[model samples]
Target: MTFPQNEVRFEQLSTASPSVIYSIEEYPGRPARFDYLSPAFEEIYEIPVAKAMENAAIAFDTFHPDDLSGYQQAVIRSAKTMQPLQHEWRIITPSGKIKWVQANSRPERRQEGVLVWHGVMLDITDRKQTEAALRESEATKKQILKAIPDLIFWMSADGICLDSMPSNDAFQLFPDSGRVGKNLYTVLPPDLAEMRRQAVEKALQTGDVQVYEQRIMLHGGFYYEEVRVVGVGDDRVLVIVRNITSRKQAEIALQESEERFRSAFQDAPIGMALIGLDDRWLKVNPVLCNMFEYSEAELLTTRMFTMVHPEDRSILQQYIEQYLGQSQTKDKKATQVELRYQCKGGQIIWVRLNLSVVRDAQRHPSYYVAQIQDITQEHAVNRMKDEFISIVSHELRTPLTAIQGFLGLLNTGIYTNNPEKTQRMLKLAMDNGDRLVRLVNDILDLERLSSGKVQLAMTTCNASELMQQAVDSIHSIADQAAVTLAVVPTKAQVWAASDSIIQTLTNLLSNAIKFSPPQTTVTLSVQTQTDSVLFQVRDRGRGIPADKLESIFGRFQQVDVSDSRQKGGTGLGLAICQSIVQQHGGNIWVESTLGEGSTFYFTLPTPDP
Candidate 1:
């Protein structure tokens, strides 16, 4: 067929559009006919156009049976209203392929009981499938959000709440406002609103996820939240809020407790140090630094064992070696030990040290905490008291034993027949009696001085006269021991209690005479100075051992126990002398060479004239 050029172009456009144009007549007993059918008929329904044009009833056969009724009803309604007919329906092609189609046209009533409709139809199969998939995805996302129990919100760039999903009542900060068409500033607090606005802007700008935390108070309890914002298209964001109130509360409580413990460790009155499993000091307090005479930095740099006294290191070393062998429990604590520690100045002081292990989160031993207290003076006093008890028991038994024996012999009439024999026995008994009296007197004198029951009578006296009187008092005892007393003449005058000075000197002379070898000279020398007088009593006796030099001044302590028993020397004389010298504001000490001799020196302060 021949056609004009414009008509040919229009025909090409229809063929390329892949649509069919149709006309319908609703006249009585008249059948509908397709006035035009594009080439798409064969491509879509698997039928040629000429066949569809011959009879419209043939194309109706391809309409899905389930959709045919709805399609017919929509067309009839549109025809009655004389409105544009728009409808969608499913069709099964002759090749058994299901396809979706849309019809768009206007219906016109030509006469009574007669209607003419013209429309174009196109395949919408891909669009319908895409829409169904989108619906399904949206449903899945909703289900997931519900399951997580999170507060999800969609907000615009201007901080307007577009949509939201509600959570539990306890966590719902804005109950009524989590809806569409609400501004964030109107619903939330001023601070939070501004923060969320800034977060929204940042998320939109960077196209990256933004996270933050905020605290809110509700119902007199603090609440914590975590907010995450992610940008969607068109300057909108999706914000997810999670309530972390419980977790935050736990963290705060833990931090506060840790801080308190840290403060206590730094400021405790007793010495404290934190040592690690490797026996290194991690930290030390001021008291510990003062006690050991080390600076904080020095202690931290030094090892714990280096500062322990050599004699007291064994037990501490044993613990360090067996640390790993102890119980693997975080709650287990180590026992305490009393030991000596060396100061920076090389002096040793007694301390009670307690150790406890600190653990990490994995229950592994991380470090150790050591608490120490100085007990040097207390321990010395306790030792002295124990020695006093032992000596007092022995001294009392000796006197009681002699008195019992003499009384028993007298009652038995053992010396009854001979008067001279009785008199000799009586004399021997009297000698022991006198010795007992002397021992008791020494005990009382030591007790009085130690307990501060005796006051010193301060007076000025000549040091030479004091030495002379002491020598004279011990003259007979020196002769009995075959020892000679040699006094170094000193013209020094001193302020002191004459009686107390005389007593101290006499005690020193008696000890020298008792321990002296035969024909040895016991020399008494007085070194006078401006502030004090130093007196020395030197004896050529079996000398004291090095270790007992300090302890000999303690009650009942002797370098050799045999010395206390053999020389008829009660251990109380030296203790009494020490007390007397100390009460007079003086110092006393002893120096000895192993086999040469011993010297006792004491200093008495001289009052200013």
Candidate 2:
């Protein structure tokens, strides 16, 4: 076909355009034909323009099968109404590739009853793919927000709520009507609003996330929340709030329990300690520090085994090993042992140790807890009890054997023929019986005083008179021993039981006289003091050994074991004296030199003025 000069120029311009520029004509009872087609049409559909112009059906065949019916309907409507057509539809290329295209055109009627349309068609495949990807991304974001339980908000920089995605109505702070345009100051408490304002300002300024915690009351209950804010753009922020009430309550409960345990550990009466796995002292209570005579700082820096007595450390170590080797089950019992501990001052003391283990989640040993009770006094008492039983048994058997043998012989008439022999034998047996009686009496008296069963009748007495009476009572014994008794009298008054004081003085005098040499003097004197009267009995006799001074006051204890048998002493006189003096709130002690003498001293509280 030949075109006019202007038409040729228009066709040349259309050849270089990206979009296909075309014109088509339609006649009644006739098919449509392209009056003009740009070179882009051939490039877009991979078909020759000459072929498409010869049969417009060549172009119509490129319409995707699914879009053909809709495309035809849109064209028919636009033709009847002579309206502009603006539509997008899918088309397939001659190469079997599917693509999207947009058509924008206007229809006009010509005088010969022919309809004509002029427009541009664009291949919008890339643009359609981009739009599809955007839609998919938006759908994915909605699904993710739906799955989370946190409350999310897009807020403006001025603390206005622009939009919100609440996981549920329970977490929504405001009604639907109150949201969107509401300010935080109206929706939240004043203090909470201020806190959020500060966080918002900080997030916008630094472009960093601001995180904080808030406790809110909602629906007549308390809720703890963790809020995080981050700048989404220059004028807006994304806020996320998570409810953490359960976790926070658990933490608070754990902290309170730890505080209670600390108080109990510190206030316990028995010694207690927490030891680390390395055998070092992690914590020590006040009682433990006092028991070991070490400060808390000293104990913490030292290993636990260092304070244990050398002979007992191995035993403690073995016990710990055995305990750790066993599985820690819920029904397992704590391990206990009695061992000795060496004090900081080098004194050894017995302790009953109760040990328990603490474990980690994996049931591995983490640390140890120890409870220690001082048992030193208990051990000493037990030892004394055993010794007392043995001594009493031997003492009673001796005199009973002699009395029984002599009586048996007399009853058998073995001495009936000798009157003088019988009399002597009878005297010996009677003497043994008297000794047995004296032993029994002394035991009963000592027991009564030791057990607090004997309550002394206290009275204000003259110290000089008590001394005189004690000396006089023991004067016959001193005479038999040929030991002189002298008294340095004092006019001091003592608040004491008269009979007990006299007996105490008598026992001291008698002991002195027995150990004194012939012609040696035994002096009894009293010295008055501010709050007490000091009584002294001095003798020139074989002195007590220094080591035996303290033990001599115990029942059945004596410096010379044979003294009880040879001197006719019951070995309980000094013990009785000690008990009596103690009951009167007095103290008794002895000072002795090896060969010179021994002086026994006792102090009794003076009578109240």
Candidate 3:
């Protein structure tokens, strides 16, 4: 509504209000004059109505010179458009008192084609002073933020770059050519631009601060940035970019180092572990956990001592204490030692555990960096090699003994004088030749298995009959040991190469007979399980120790190394059995109790129904 009309209406009210009312007329390029002066002006401005009506410009002439030209232009433009003129100006009276003045005026076109302004002017000095002070404070605050070394920027409600301070490093890092006055989409790297735009838009819509990390392509090279976006005045946004390249490089170096460790951990043909400061495992790779038959998580949660074989724990504990104590000492640095750890299934594994210390900034011990390697396989092979040397020595003696016995007979010349004695010597010589042939065959079989050169003539046959045939073949050996041999037959048939199964069963039966006590029964049982047929050979002789049960089927492995050849057999028999069973998608295992007896079991797949 027009202020003049409103003031006229306000005066017509029967009930008087406390509001002060006045109207004025303004001319373009001329002074603005009060056309109507109300008595309320005297109280509002502390000036008489006649004094204000006489000259409106007298109150405004004391305004700051900087505002005079702008105010004059505003009135002129308003008169031309017949629009309203609204402005706030400062005034200083003759008494040297400064005050704020606010004026609102609308122009009217007269019939004479001249435009005249009619409006109202109120003394808004108090409100104007407060607003001026606020603007000054805001200018000072922006100067402070701009002075910081970091890049600070602001985006508009639509994601366009509205204002920025310091430099355009933020835009230079992006793949886009130029970013000034452009939207985030136009300035972002092609791959990540869309993502960044979406994230910023989402934050704007939700009015929430968003934080993220990204690799930005800059003129120099790629850089990692930690970015944060916060909502500010009038739907604007403040974004900050922090350079975290050094921290990222450190993490990458650590990751690469960890990968190197993993390669050593998995492919080292040994088990490894990462232990914590308190002797607990913090990390364990596949091989390490696999050696102990424990899951990685399960191993990590348990203490290292819990897995140590009890017999070696005290000795191992001392080494562990010494290593850790040395690593913790300021002068000692890191330490490495070889120790024994028990598997989850009560197997002792010899491991060479190498340990180092990871320290924090405070130089305090943080964690134990450990590398555990299981050397059981190596140890087993070494022991077998020693046994093999002994077996070779015994084998060498067999021929020498025969030669020595014949020479002794010749020394008496009794074999030459007596035809029967000479014939007995010839027979003994032939028996020794046969024994040498068997020894050579055993060695050749082991070579073939190790080189993966053993090929099977596969044929499906009845599993029970194969067991019976092997039992019959070993019957003579059982009789020599004075051990009764029994075969428990099964009705189930299997699909496998008959000859291989026969050979596997023969080895098991012969071992049972050789190890059995005189006149004790050696039982051979065949039964059918869900997917495979089971064959077992149990003897009444002294059983194998639990520690050696798994390795019994390995090449050149023997329960009693000293008597292995004396028992009239080669150690490769069980190894061949294992190879045959594995070739047919089956397995062989042993259950033994020390000083009792052993049961050797093998499985063959049942024929398809």
Task: Give the per-residue lDDT of model 1 (tens digit) for 1-609.
Answer: 456987898788877887866666666577766666778777777888888788777888999999999988997798779999999999999889999999888887776777877878888999999999999999898888777645788999998888877654456555634367888888779999899999999999999999999999888988998999999996799988888888899999989989989889888999998898788899999999999899999889888888788877898877655664675643556778889888989989999888878888888889988999988898998886786676687777776676677667777986788788667667767766766787888888888888897778888788999999999988998998899999999888778888888998998898888888999999999997769999999999889999999989977787777786577777778888899889888899999997899999999888677
Location of the lowest summed lDDT over 10 successive residues in candidate 3: 13-22
Regions more than 4 Å wrong, model 3: 1-98, 102-121, 137-171, 174-271, 276-278, 286-303, 309-311, 320-331, 336-338, 343-351, 357-366, 373-609
Q: Order the numbered candidates by lDDT, best leading.
A: 2, 1, 3
Candidate 2 per-residue lDDT over residues 1-609, each given as its tens digit: 456987888867899998989888989788889998898988888899899999999998889989989987898999889899888898888899888989898898998889888999999999999999999999899889867777888899999999887555565444345577789998889999999999999999999999999999988987788999999989999988888888888988899999889989998999999999888999989999999899999889989788888889999989887877764555258879889988889899999998899888888888888899999999899887888888898888888988898889899987889999889888888888888998898899889998998889999999999999998898999999999999996789999999989999999999999999999999999899889999999999999999999999988888987997778788999999999999999999999998999999999999999
Shift in Å, residue 8, candidate 2: 4.2
Query: Best by lDDT, which number?
Result: 2
Better of 1 and 2 by TM-score: 2
Error of 3 at 188 (Å): 6.5
- Superposed model 2: Cα runs more than 4 Å off: 1-9, 25-35, 42-73, 92-96, 111-113, 171-177, 217-222, 262-279, 282-286, 304-307, 320-334, 337-341, 351-374, 389-553, 558-609
TM-score of each: 0.61, 0.69, 0.40
RMSD of each: 9.4, 6.5, 15.7
Q: Where is model 1 more than 4 Å wrong at Cα?
A: 1-11, 20-36, 46-66, 92-98, 106-118, 139-169, 177-244, 328-333, 358-364, 396-609
| Residue pairs that clash (backbone atoms under 3 angstroms), model 2 | none
